[model samples]
Target: MFFASDNSGPVHPRIMEALMEANQGHAMAYGADALMDEVRARIRDIFEAPEAAVYLVATGTAANALALATLAQPWQTVFCSPVAHIHEDECNAPEFYTGGAKLTLVGDTDRISAEALRAAIEAEETRGVHGPQRGPVSLTSVTERGTVYGLDELRAVTAVARDYGLPVHLDGARFANALAALDCSPAEMTWKAGIDAVSFGGTKNGCMGVEAVIFFDPAHAWEFELRRKRGAHLFSKHRYLSAQMAGYLRDGLWLDMARQANANCARLVAGLRAAGMEFLHDPQANMAFPILPLRTHRRLHEAGAAYHLWNGTLDGDDPDQPIAARLVCDWSISSDEIDCFLNLLRA
Candidate 1:
């Protein structure tokens, strides 16, 4: 019943074993290890991008910030949804890494529309040197609100960026989850959709802590390498990161984990519907945003269930009032756990 975050879940056993094996002998440091070569090649094959430049970091924030820094200049502003992870959750790391580049909120919703993005891009650079110039467009899949963009939607947004002669960056912090839900190839969701770079995330799926930043064109490879090192995100024992990703990608473990997570979310959604809860967003991938009665929330809390309250606290006067809850299901969440949670809600 611990739905606090996928971040709290345990690392997959295979990933842990891979880490143990990687620690047995000496290896090159700072991403020069042989394991890193396998990771690069594997990601390239997965994305059908042979020339893509792939680099690993310990956090999704570092991945997004460095990738954006490579695509956008300091004098420019990045366009993104108002609730994008890069905007709301990254703590301005993107601005810092881009050397003061600004973030322009494109739409009021968690998902940005093509029209909204075009208007936002046009709104920028209208003042010429007086205001921030238009930079790269960043789109988040499996958006903060738990909804995903279809392939057509992705193409539309990226097409809008292309019209403005802007590169597009995808903040795919839940890349595997989105891919599982969309049932599309990595290429279709990214480069094929006109994305210039992607923050290929792994941590929120099943890895311990590793995210890959992949540039489809490879033109900004050196710049990204320099920025990563300068940003202090370069890991000395880099093989550890490599081993985790290798184990994750091996035997399609990444997809399997994502499938299980998405299935768990669907199960939870069904249970929530049975309990007569209202969803704040469509349940997609591994996340669900639902509004439950305050009385139900209090029961769950008293039963030691852990999860995040998205909108309101439990101290309100009306016990029947509805408040939003963000429930995240990882690969490890069991049917029994979800059943227990559902049973509690029913009670």
Candidate 2:
């Protein structure tokens, strides 16, 4: 049972077929391909933003970093959760890409509350030109803890940023998963709720390493294009990225995959619950964090079950010590695989 990460899943057949088709003949280079035009138009229709600016990159880091670099200045600080991917997992790419713009972590948890966000933003710029000025409020839906931000929760935090006239960015690495959980349209979850830019992800859901950076306001397009090119994220042969995204959006395959992954996660959560697993956060999308006993963890590890242990090592003395672990379900994981995991847990 492979529950290590959605990023470890295989690409969907449709996405692979799209890539094969894209390899048929010669095409233009560096975003000039016809496939890219279709991908852009499709995203605009999906998001209901006719005037939005769309660009593609191979990794979520590139998408987030380049987009943020375009939105934020070097002398500012971005507000985000303490466990946000941009802050914890990105190896300071956002900082480097934004030209030394630092992150001011808001709440201590993965989810940032509006009250905490307001306090964080207010706490910045207190010293005259000494402290970093508040730049953008970056929120991660389907937070790192396997929890999703409700629509109201998203709006509350975005509204706080609005109060201070700061822009908002969504680190939507799990954007499709969040949409499946929330059952909301792209517009409702984003621009309508005051999000300025989003890194619309596809790699984790079904595609073969492709993410789109979308700016609801088209004015940021030129600056972003320059930043992407400067950051070495601009692909010389960009049609492959275009094909993966096009296939992902084709016939709403992206949503279908997301729904399946979310359903798989729900099943996994139910099975974990039946096994008396204590959860760190409610499973909302394709991720779950459960506290497993050290003995149980050792058993699962030896049995070839793959997952990340979030807390404590298996070498500890106590066999019954609770150790948290992260389990992720991708669109490709079968129900049988999930059952196998639960069976192992029960054993």
Candidate 3:
């Protein structure tokens, strides 16, 4: 039973086959390959933004940081939740890419409320030239806490950004999973809801390593390209990246994989709830943050279960003390594995 991370999962077989097929021919370097053209077209069609500009990078960090750098100025501060991936997980890549733009934690919780965001934005730019100006608002769907912001919540937050005349960026590292959970279209979840840019992820879904940086306005395209190149994220053998994305988008495979992953998480959550387990966060998307006893954790670990303890370690002496664990579901995790994990926990 492996639930460490979606990143640990194998690339889907179809994606591997696409890579193999792409290996047969020489393609243009630096994202000019025919596969890139297909990918761009497919993404634009999916998002219903015919004029949108889509570009690929090998990592989610590159996609998010570069996109933010393109949107916000160095003198400004990005507004986000304290637990946002950009704030917590990226290790200041956004700050580095934006050339020293600071991150302002909007709320104590993972989900930023509209009121909190407005107050944070207003609190900034009040200090004049001596302090950081207000920058783009960055929101993460499928937040690190394993909770998702509903469509209305997304719109509410983005509307707050629009009120301040600031741009908005979405850190969509689990874009597909969130999409699958919400049952919403790409456009509805993004630009239509006031998102200026997006880090459309594929690696966490089923692709090897590829994330697309999409700008609905398309005006950020040139700046993003320059930033990506300057950041040294440009791959010479770029077709490989293109091929992965093309394969991921093919035949709605991205949605299918995300649905499977979410289903797995739901099943895991259901089983845990049935056993009267308490949870840190409501299981949502492809992640379930359940609070388990330390003794149960040690037993699961000993039984060959793989997952990360969120708030507490397994070495503690208190057997009945509750600590949180982060269980992430990959598209490939079988139902048997979930049941096996549940059984181990029960035992």
Please give the lDDT score at residue 175 for candidate 3: 89
lDDT of 3 by residue, 1-347 (tens): 99999999999999999999999968989998999999999999999999999999999999999999999999999999998888888889999999999999998998999999988888888878999999999989888887888989989998888888999998999989989889989999999888889999999999999999999998888998899999999999999999999999999999999999999999999999999998887888899888899999999999999999998898898899899998999999999999999998888
Enumerate clash totals for all models, in the order shown. Answer: 0, 0, 0
Q: Write the per-residue lDDT of candidate 1 for residues 234-275, one digit (tens) a residue.
A: 999999999999999998999999999999999999999987
Native-referenced Cα lDDT, model 1: 0.93
* Model 1 regions lying over 4 Å from their true place: none
Model 1 pairs whose backbones collide = none
For each candidate, what is the lDDT?
0.93, 0.93, 0.93
